[model samples]
Target: MKVAVHPDRRPSHEAEVIAFSYHRLALDLARHLGRDVNNWYCYAVWASKAVSENLDLSPGSCFLGDVAARLNVPVWLRRPFRRVFLALLGPSYPLALALANRAIFLEMGSLAAELWDADDDYLIRVDETGDFVRRPEFLSALLAPAEEEFLDAVVRLFTKARNATGPERAEFVLGANIALVAYEQQRAQRLLELVLNRPPRWLLQGSWRWLWCALRRRPFHRLAIYTAPHAELAWPARKAERWWVRFYTSRLMVMRTPVGRIQLGRPLPPPKGAAPETVWAPIQDLEVRELVDRFLPSDFDRATAGVGNWLSFDDRMRFIVAYFRMYANVPELFDPPFTSDKLDELEAEMDEGHVPEPYQEWLQKENARRAAAGRGVRGLIARQRYRSPFRSDPDAAALAGFDLTGCVHRRTLRPEAGPEALLCCGIDGELCGDAGGRCGRQA
Candidate 1:
């Protein structure tokens, strides 16, 4: 049999479809049991204040708007007047609209009241707290002892409807599933299985499992692991882990290497064997070249021409990290041509900061230049102890094993050295300090 196609289902549409299905099922059950059931109510309890504020009054607002639009006024005048009136009234406009369209508003309000009323007989409250009480005291008080049989019949009928083959079956099952959400979960599962002959595939899907775990108050880590293998390595999972680590472990250390960055439990002890005297390592020229090549030609020229000296340490660090991360993740996004001239220009810019200039004067000049070029002026300037000389001709073979140590060293690299220098440290202990020569203090 050919089934009618549905409109593309947005979140709201899915909700509405489920609600309509549940209402129909409730009506069918009432008719089957020879009892009068006026309305079915579905209440979604929100733990978040923000979510409650966004959703609770949405339907009422829509109802009010529909009522206002049907007010016999011409469409052109009506829309303009409505906007002006709403603008003037601010938060109180909904109340004013309800009052103006009392008849229609009241009718809509009555329907809403039936669905939202705590005293309604066929109420289903989904607890955000995850306590799916199958039969709350208030609900128990409303039903006679014998009426429990009617509820059983309702569940069985819903199960049958859920199992039937049709386009509507999925929607029917969804609605039935929600209605039975508060049921003793095991009993609901068995009844559904008896009718459908198998567990619903949706119940085992990732999104559904996530929702189920969330409702059951599972910890985020547990939820993450439950949903995906090696989820701890996933970005959001790592972020969640980091948040807890930051809260509990005050001394976590982050180390950057040639291969990848690593988070350590604590700072490493000093090298046991003979280590290199120079603590800081020189940044690979290839990395610097890559950064220059990644930049737009105009940006490359501007940055190379001492414009980088104008950028604050933080801005420089941010720009560098952003560039590298983008390059690593989506290299296709960048398509800039590399030129020897631009590299030479960058090398020229690096000459100005060989000897540290007066911090305030350098900042003033940078800010003035930025403002002259229609860019925002820098507010704060950080003092720099040393700056690296940029190499115009970077050796590709020499940089084959280049490792960007950490952000501390990257912040000190000369602008002409390119953005990648943000990851490398000086080898002469100029940046990190000498062994037993205040290296720990410098870090």
Candidate 2:
């Protein structure tokens, strides 16, 4: 029988083709992702902030305009010119790349020379141990030959392109390149695992996951070895046994003694008629994973905003809390319920010693009515007493990750208490210690 060609079956046959399109879309996309890094206008905001901090220069109230004018080079020319500017200012490009590691900022030393279009002979000084490799040369040598070549080529291309653009353009292009490189590196690693170990069918559909697979050299196993009780052990079987399992077989075999397997605990007798359960369910549901994926990025963004880097411990905790909040809707995940009216009412209530006689009598009568009916009056009265979002001491203690016993003194103490007296209870240590430093200290 003659068969018709299905559009989806042919990998080479694209759904739509561009006319006179000589360029490969992948290459063009990669180039575009790299080139748009440093937008000059964005750099000006940073440069403006940098100049504003310089009180000694005293640009005055018009300092922003002066900084803009002083640094206003075309985007294309900005790269090479900024190199000269920074060199003249005494802070080199390497210095800036060594400090910044976020989406917006990069450290001086961590910056690649390709970023500046400087001579390839440029060297970064390294000390003993070599644990922290800063220079592109060192990194290039350490990475796989293909990766090193690709990276160096990219650096060379950007450096060459730098001369064609202004200082502002150079910075923006470099910024775009930096973001793209970080993103691609992440993608390549993820894709490599995916190809090598065959992930679940569902993961391949997502835009982000597909991007990862495109960049990675191998696919990884989606389900873990510890997925549920008995799911037939999702593995490539023999190949995995030789490649990844043999290294630790001796320890695993130790549990397989003559008496009984460590986990067997005397095998149950097989039933003559009963059939084994067939359907398998994953321990972690797809919904939980989706929720976690959605919430975790926002938490990371929040942490990055509060602190310089997203790798800090507090930032990790913030991400964990955000994940758990989506995992299970718990009140402790949120801040004290804050309402403007409740705050105003609390302030008003504090101003007066007692409610009007009529109001007080009515409250007493209601409390008596509730008590006479055998329904609790205390809870009802307490509910009416506080404003919405007004957290009790217990709730506040839970939110701050402290036991009620540890915060007994805080309950008795008023907000007006002196800092010294308040901290005398050692709640400083109990509370996440100077919010910014807490994560750093843990790290």
Candidate 3:
């Protein structure tokens, strides 16, 4: 018999319906809310699900989630696994596991009571029953366990979040956004305030905070960017935004210039709504208290600890898997990349022919170019040639286009793919979101 079921009840993987709680759902939301390594690996797996592209998906992806659980990350992460030299990075394992734990929710599913809709008091028409029933009663039956039991868990989760205070509430805070609940208007506004750090009316040095808001696609809202990762971000989840992500195109001009400094399309700020406050989303894979005790940075006041042009990770092979520090909020996992030795040490290595051939050649020409330019002569390379409004680093789409207009779309991270608006179209039809998992499966 056919019955209306929410998309949340029918996960792409059947097991997901059973394992999913606010935890896994929050991780899913995080991917949609911001850009991370999961986007890259998930795209490859989804594009070739038939071909069985070698990549990770279930149980969580790298960095922001449970990448530590499976040390053998997908090839994309492996490609970036390097011995970056920086003192700021200490140990990656503790923090990697911390992020992984943050993605697990064994006890938070009870908040399902918030699923009740008092506004319209929906009625469900089950084909088998041939009768009308309260929407809450019908939908609650879709849960894996007793409706009341799940409601208890959900209530506890939401109450904890509503009652919590300070930065310690970040994990539950992220979970609140994704947890199945029907929040009152007042409660919703409060939740938004808890997650978002609204910059005061007063401005800052050089208007960096203002630019953060303007570029994030939310010109009206005056908010800041997350100083760290995963939370305090106001990413676009509108229908138009999703469509653009799936169909947005750009110009290809990689070959126009042989070599020179080229603009990378203004270097978008975290690719979404991010703020300056650093909040650590809790993880459950490891000892929650232990993870925070040992790995949490003692100082969050590093001068250069602010957002970087690109996120950096500390990669190392340890224990049963390779530990990585990719969470911008937790620099403790990064590698220590400073040395007090004399300047001649690095110069001596370069002089000893240790530099790669391409860089060595570039160096010789660069010095000659600088000298020639000083003398008012032509340099080895010409001016920078740029194309595309977002990025021009030769992505998968741009390479395939091989045309003047190298069109591209977001391979993953679509809004419908996350916790989003419900279609709620027909009374007799299934209570579906537009997704139906078709677009998600395609991505």
Per-residue accuracy of model 2 over 1-443 as CA lDDT, tens digit each:
00011111111111001100111222233243333332222222222223223211122323223333445656566556544533232211111111111111111112231233343322121111233222222221111111111223234434444444443333323323332233223222322222222222222222245346446833422122211112243444434423432222212111111122221112121223322221011113232232233223433334222221122223333333232222121112121122456435433432332211111112223333444445367656555553211122122112122111111111011212221222122121123334221222210
Q: What's the C-alpha lDDT at position 150 in model 3?
A: 17
Error of 3 at 367 (Å): 62
Per-residue lDDT over 298-401 for candidate 3, one digit per residue giving the tens place of the 0 to 100 score: 33332213222111111001100101112223211111111335223322322232211111111223323444554223332322322221122122112111
Please give the RMSD to the true structure for each candidate, in Å. Answer: 36.8, 32.8, 25.9
The TM-scores of all predictions, comma-separated, are 0.17, 0.17, 0.18
Off by over 4 Å in 1: 1-7, 34-179, 182-226, 229-443
Better of 1 and 3 by TM-score: 3
lDDT of 1 at 27: 44
User: Which run of 10 residues does model 2 get worst, by summed lDDT?
Assistant: 13-22
Model 1 scores worst on lDDT over the 10 consecutive residues at: 404-413
lDDT of 1 at 396: 14
Candidate 2 off by > 4 Å: 1-146, 166-443
**TM-score of decoy 3:** 0.18
